[model samples]
Target: MRRFVYCKVVLTTSLVWVLVDVFLLLYFSECNKCDDRKDRSLLPALRAVMSRTHEGPGEMGKAVIIPKEDQEKMKELFKINQFNLMASDMIALNRSLPDVRLDGCKTKVYPDDLPNTSIVIVFHNEAWSTLLRTVHSVINRSPRHLLVEILLVDDASERGRGNFMKLRGAAASRGQVITFLDAHCECTVGWLEPLLARIKEDRKAVVCPIIDVISDETFEYMAGSDMTYGGFNWKLNFRWYPVPQREMDRRKGDRTLPVRTPTMAGGLFSIDRSYFEEIGTYDPGMDIWGGENLEMSFRIWQCGGSLEIVTCSHVGHVFRKATPYSFPGGTGQVINKNNRRLAEVWMDEFKDFFYIISPGVVRVDYGDVSARKALREALQCKPFSWYLENIYPDSQIPRRYYSLGEIRNVETNQCVDNMGRKENEKVGFFNCHGMGGNQVFSYTADKEIRTDDLCLDVSRLNGPVVMLKCHHMKGNQMFEYDAERLTLLHVNSNQCLDMPSEEDKMVPTLRDCNGSRSQQWLLRNMTLSM
Candidate 1:
C-alpha cells in the first residue's frame, strides 16, 4: 500500500510540472507578439496613447483663446519669454499639430534604410511647457528606430547666452546624424524620414525643414510659405524671399522637391555626423547665437557642399517679436561681434559691403579668426564671388558695384534715406548722420540704386521718388550718376533724383535733369569697383 501511494504522488507532481511549463510558454509567446507590434508600429502606438482628439486648448493646432479675466495676467507673463507662457501652460504637452505638408509630400516614399539621427536641443531658461512639448512632439511623431536619442543641451550662462553648447552635444552624440532643433519647436509627422534620407543619399547635403510659425500670442500653428527661401539683408540678418524662377524651372515646378536655399533660419536643421566634422562644424569662435546660420550656410556652399530646404518636411516654431533673454555685452554688440567674425572669415572682399552698411561694426574687436581662415584655406573652398554668381545669383549684395555708401545731396547736405520704409513708400531725405543705416545705398552693376532689397524708383515724370522692390528688369529702377555733372539721371523717367523741394520738405522728387544744386548729389566714399 505504501509503494502504490508513493508512485501516485510522483505522477501527480510530474503532471503539475508539465502544466506550469505550458502556461509559461503561452505567456512568453504573447509577449513576443506584443514586442513585434511595438517594433513595427511604434509611432501609431505613441499617437494612440499621447494624442487627444477632444476639443480643448491648443487642440488640432487651433489658437487658444485666453479668457477675458486672464488678459492682464497673460500680458504680464508674456514678457518672461516673449511668448504667451500662460497659454502654453494651458495646452497639453502632447498637443496635436496639423499635417501642414502638401498632398504630393504625403504620397512621397523615402528609402527604408534611412539613417538614424540624434536631436540636439539647446535651451537656456526656456519655458517649462514649450520645452517639454518640443520633446513629446518628437517622440510621438518620429519613428522609434529612426530617432536614436534626444540630447537637451542647457548651456545657460550667468550672462544669459549659450556658448559652445552645440559642440558639446555633437561630441556626446552617438547617432549617425545630428539634428539641431530650437527649444521651442514642434515636430510634425514624417519630419524625420526626409531629413535623414537626404543626408543618407548625399552626406554633404545639409538640409532644413520648412519652419512653420506658432503664434506668440495665442499659440496658434500657422503654415509658413513653402515658396519662400532664406536670404539675408546687408546687415546679415536672415530674410525670406520667393524661390526664384530659375530654381522652379530646375525642379520643373515640383513643389515637393528640395529647394536650394542661400541660407537657413538657423534654428532647425540636420547634418550627417561624419560630414559635419569633415566640414568643420560650427565656428568655435562664434559667441552665443547670431550669425551662425549664415556662417554655416556660406561654409556649406563654398566648401563644395549643398544647402537645401526639404519642402516635404515641416516643423513649427514660435516666432517671437523680441528676445526675452539678455546678452552679456548687449544684443547689438554681441550680434555685431559675431557677424564681424563671419565677414572677416567668409565674405572675403564682400566683407566691405557689410562694414559699409554697418559702419559701427568696425569698432567692435572681433576675436581671432585665424583658425577659421585656416580651415577655409585647407578646404580649398571656392571664393565668395563664385558663391554670389553661382549659388546665390540673386543676392542683394551686388557682385559688382560702382559705389556703396551714403547718397548725399550737395546743397541740403541731407542724405537719401530709406526712412526705414517698406516697398512703395516715398523715399525721404534725412540729415546726413555719417552712420550707415537708413542713409546707405548701393549703385549696383545692374545700374539700380539699391538699398537692402528696395531700389529708388520713379515711373512717371515728377513722380515721388519712391522705394520699390528692386526688380532686376530695371525699367524704372535704372539710374546713371554723372560723376562729372554730380547729377543722378533716371533712365526711364529722363529725370534726376532732386532733393526735397521747398514745397515738399521731406520727400525727394524726380524732375527733368538740370545741373542745379538740388539735383547735384555726391556718392560719399564711392569706390569705382564697377
Candidate 2:
C-alpha cells in the first residue's frame, strides 16, 4: 500500500512540474510577442488581412506596389521552390479570406451524430510557415467536437520506408475518420461540417471539399468554381470538367448538394478509417505522388464505394508549377512506373489504350502487380469497365484507330494544322514533311481525329477545318468517318473534308466530296509520320 502511495505521489509531482513548465513556456511566449509588438508597430497588412479592419486588400486587381527588396526576395524563393514562398511568408497565418460560399449553402446543417475526423497532413521540404498555417486553419475553423486529431506524415524529405503508412497507423487509434491534405493548404470557415456529414451518411463515401486555389505567384486565396467536378482522360491525368446536367438534376434545385465525381484531382480528401482499410488503403508500392489519385478513385468506385465532392465544404491549396523536392530515378520514371501498375491491375484489356496514348509508359517496368491483382480479387471489386460504364458514362473509351498519323494532303505534302486558324487560334496547316509534331493526330473508334484534347471541328459547311476542345458529346465535336469511301465526312455539317484546288488556298475547307486527289490523305504510322 505504501509503495503504491509513493508511486502516486511521484506521478502527481511529475504532472505538477509538467504543468508548471507549460505555464512558464506560455508566459515567455507572450512576453516575446509583446517585445515583438514593441519593436515594430504591427504590419499594415495585418489589420487589412486578418481582422477586416481594412477589407479588399488582397483583391488588388493590378499589381500592388511591392518594394524592390520584396521583389528580389520573391524571385529568390521561386528559385528555391517554384512557388512564391516569400509572398507566402509575408501573408498573415490567420489571414481572413472572403467567404466564397453560395447563399443556398449557408443554411445547411449537419446532424449532431457526425463522426469526428483526424486530418492527416503529409509533407517533404514544405515551407514552415505554410505548413503551420494549414494546421492553425483547421484548429481555428473546425468545430472542436468534430475534429479528433491532426496527423502529420513526414516523408523525411528524402528516401524513407513509408512515412505515410506510419502516419496512418498512428492516427488509427485516434479518430474514426481520416483526412489527407497537402502541407501548404488553407481551410475556409465552414469546410469541415459538410464533409463529415456526408461521410456519416455513408461510411463508404470518400468525400472531398471543393478545392480553392491559393495562388503560387501571389499568396491570394482564390475562389474556385463550384460548377466543376474531378475528371480524367485516357492518360489518367486529372482534369476539371463542368458538372453534368444529370449530376445537377440530382441536387433538386439546391446548389449546396454534394456532387458525385468520376475521379479525384488528388491532394485533399477525407475517408472513413474502416472503409479505407477494407478498400485496402493506398497501393503501398506507389512512389511519391502522381498516378495515385486516379488509382484510388478507380478503387473506390469499382469497389462498391462512391467518391463525391462536397460543394459546401471548401479548402484552398497552393498550386505550384514544379515540385520542390528531389525524387530518385527522376519524377517522370516514377510517375510512369506508378501509372503502369495502375493500368496493369485495374485497366484490364483497356490498359492497351493507355499504352496507345502514351507509348513510353509501355516500356516502364511497373514492378510486381501480383499482390495488387490478388488484393483486387480478394476485395471482390467490380471490373474497371463497370466504372467506365456507370460512374463515368461520359468518358470516351479510345480504341486502336485504323489510321494513327498526321492528316496530310498527299498531293501538296502539307500537313493539316490547327494554327494560323482563328476559330481555335490554334487551327492550320504548316509545311508538310514526313515528320509529324503537332501535326501528329489519331482517329479514334468514336470517329474523331484528336491530338490530346483537341478535336477536328466543322463549325459550318464550307468553313476552314478547325480544332476545338473535345467535349465527346457527339455535337459539332463529333465526325463520322467513311473508311470504305475514303471520304472524311462531318456528321453535323454534312460536308466532306476538302483541300480546295484553287491557287493560294492554304486552309483545308469543307465542301462536296468529289473523290479528288487533293482531298485524299495518307496515314504513315511509324512515329506518327505524315
TM-score, one value per model? 0.88, 0.80
Model 1 residue 225 distance off true place after TM-score fit, in angstroms: 1.6
lDDT of 1 by residue, 448-505 (tens): 9999999988879997888888889978999888989999899887898888778888
Candidate 1: misplaced stretches above 4 Å?
1-53, 161-163, 526-530
Model 2, C-alpha of 261: deviation from truth (Å): 0.5
Lowest-sum lDDT 10-residue window in model 1: 1-10
Evaluated against the true structure, the overall lDDT of model 1 is 0.83
| Candidate 2 pairs with clashing backbones | 417-428, 418-426, 418-427, 418-428, 419-426, 419-427, 419-428
Alpha carbon deviation, residue 249, candidate 1 (Å): 1.1
For all predictions, the C-alpha RMSD in Å is: 13.1, 8.2
- Clash counts for all predictions: 0, 7
Query: Could you give candidate 2's per-residue lDDT for residues 1-530 as a string of tens digits?
Result: 00100000111214323322332333334342346554233333323334332233343211123568678866887877678776665565555667778887787777998899877776655565576568667876888888766665545434532435434543443678888777888898899999999999999999999999887887777778889998886567888988888888888866788899999987789899888888878887887778888998999998889999999988999888877766788878888988998988998877766665567787787888899899899989998888877888767554445666567776677777655333374356668654444555777777787766677877777765677777767777666666566567777887777775464366677877777766677655535111
Model 2 vs. true fold: TM? 0.80
Model 2 clash number: 7
